[model samples]
Target: MKWTRAVHHLTDLVEKVSEMPGTHFRFEVVELWVFGDLLGAPRDLEHIDVALVVDLPVDEVPWLTEPLGAEHWANASRVSRNPVMPFWRSAQAPVWNHRIERPALAWSKADGIAEETLVAVGDGTGELVRLPAPEPDELRKRLDDELALSLAALRHDNQVYTDRRWSPGKLTPYADALWRTTTGYLDLLDALAR
Candidate 1:
C-alpha cells in the first residue's frame, strides 16, 4: 500500500477505536508515533509502523486483588488480546532488538496538542488532510539528538569490540560499518544545520 493510504487507514482505525464505548473499559491514547521506512515517503510500502502510547485506567479492572498487580496484569492482558495486536507487536518489535535508533514522527490528535506533532484528519470524502510539518528548528534538534545517541552507541560498541579476546578480528567489520553509519548521520545533520 502507499504510505499516504496506509496513514489514512491507521488514522481511521484509531478514530474508530477511540469512539468505541468506554463502558467495557477506559483508556486513553496519549500519543501516536510513526517510524521506520514509512517516513521516507516511499511510493509503496509493505507496512507502516506506529507506536501508540496508551493509558489504561487500572481502577476499572476491579477484579485484581491489588492496584499495582492490576496495573501490571492489565497491561500484559491488554497487549495479548488487543484488536490491533499484530500492529502493536510489529511496532514494539524494534524496541526489543534496539533497532529503533532513528527518530519517529509523532502523530498528534489535534493541533496545538504537543511539539513535533503531526496531525492528519479526514476530509469527509475519504481523503486525509495533513497539517503542516514540524518547523525546521524542531527537525534539526531531533536530528542532533539522534546523532548524539548514535555516537554514544558507537563508542560503547567500540569498547566491547576491542575488549573481547576471542574473535575481536570478526567484530572489526561490524564496528567499521557502524562507524560509517555514524558518519552518515553526522553528514546529514551538518547538511540540515547548514
Candidate 2:
C-alpha cells in the first residue's frame, strides 16, 4: 500500500521491458503517484504510471515522431510550471482559467520519466525477478487504512465530502478501466518482448 512497493513493482516492469529485444531504446520506471481518491483501491496504485522512452539516435527523432506518441511529447517543447498552483503548470502561467497546462505526472524530455522523488528507486542488479500480482483484498484494506489522511483535504470550503462520496458501486468503472489498460498493456508489452 505504500509507495515503496509500487515503486519496486514499476522498477520490475521497466526491467522486464528492457530485457526484451528491439526496443527503440529503453524503458524507464520514471514516476508514480496515487491521484484523486485511492482509498481502498483494488491495488495501491500510486495511480501508478510509467514512461517508456528510447534513446533515439539524435538523428532518429524523425523516425520516432509518428511511432512513439509524439502528441504527448509535444508538451515538452514549452517546458513550464506555475507555482501558485503546485499541481498546475503552463508555458505562460500566472494567468487565466483553461490554460493549456501540462500534466503534473508527465514525462520529461531529459529523463523521459516522471520526476517525483516521493517513491523513485532503482537497483543495479544483473537480473530482476517478476512480481506476482498484488492481492486485491489486501490492497483495499491498506487503502481503507489510508483514507483517514484525506479527511482534512475534503473538509475545505462550504462543501464537505463524506463516506457516501465513495460507494462500492462507484469503483466498478475505475476497476474496469484499470483492468482494460493494465491487462492490455501487459499483453502488448509481452508480445513486444517476444
Candidate 3:
C-alpha cells in the first residue's frame, strides 16, 4: 500500500476512535502511537500496529484492580491490569475479535480496526506510562531509514538467489515483485522529500 493511503487509513481510525461514545467501551482513547511495519511505509504492508493509551474508567471493569504480571512492567515500564490485548475485544465484551458493519473507509469498514492494534487500559491511577506524541519530521526520517534498510535487505536476498543459480522461472517472478516494491519505496521517498 502507498504511504499516502496508509496515512489516510490511520486518520480514519483516529477519527473513528475519537468519535466513539464512552458508553460503548466505557473508555476513551487518550493517546495513540503508530509503530512497526506501517511506520516504514512499505509497498505491501502485512499490518498496522497501533498502541493506544486509554482511560478505562475505574468504575468500569472493576475486576482489573491489580497488575497482571511482572512481564508487563518490564516491557511497558508500567504495571497493566491485563496484557496488551486487542482493543476490539475489550470494546465488545464477551465477543473476541468481533467485526461489525459500520461506515466504510478507504481500506476497511469502520469496525475493521486492525486486529494487531492494542490498548493499554489505565485505571484512574497515574501509573500508566504516557509517551509524548512523535514528531512528523522525525517519523518521516525514520520511514526513510527503514525503507532504505528494507530495500538493502531485498537487494541482498535477490543477489543470494542469483548466486544460488535459481531458474529464470522462479527468479523472474521474485525479481519482478522486488522491483515493484523498490519502485514503491522510491515513490514514497519522493513524496516525502516534497
Highest lDDT: which candidate?
1
Candidate 1 lDDT over 123-167, as tens digits, reads 221112222345566656645554564556556546766675366
TM-score of each: 0.35, 0.22, 0.29
Regions of model 2 farther than 4 Å from truth: 23-46, 54-194
Q: Which residue window of length 10 is worst by lDDT in model 3?
A: 95-104
Full-model lDDT for every candidate = 0.41, 0.29, 0.38
**Which should have the higher TM-score, number 2 or number 3?**
3
Per-residue lDDT of candidate 3, residues 24-71 (tens digit): 443444444444444332455544444444454322211112112213
Question: Model 2 clash pairs?
Answer: 33-46, 34-46, 40-143
Q: What is the lDDT for 157 in model 2?
A: 10
For each predicted model, how many residue pairs clash, with residues at least 3 apart or on different chains? Answer: 0, 3, 1
Q: What ordering of candidates by TM-score runs from best to worst? A: 1, 3, 2
The Cα RMSD of model 2 versus the native structure comes to 19.6
Per-residue lDDT of model 2, residues 1-194, tens digit only: 45445445444433343343343323222222212221122344433432233443321121101213322332231111111111111212111111111113323333544424223232211112112233556434433322221222223211322332365546543443334334433433343344
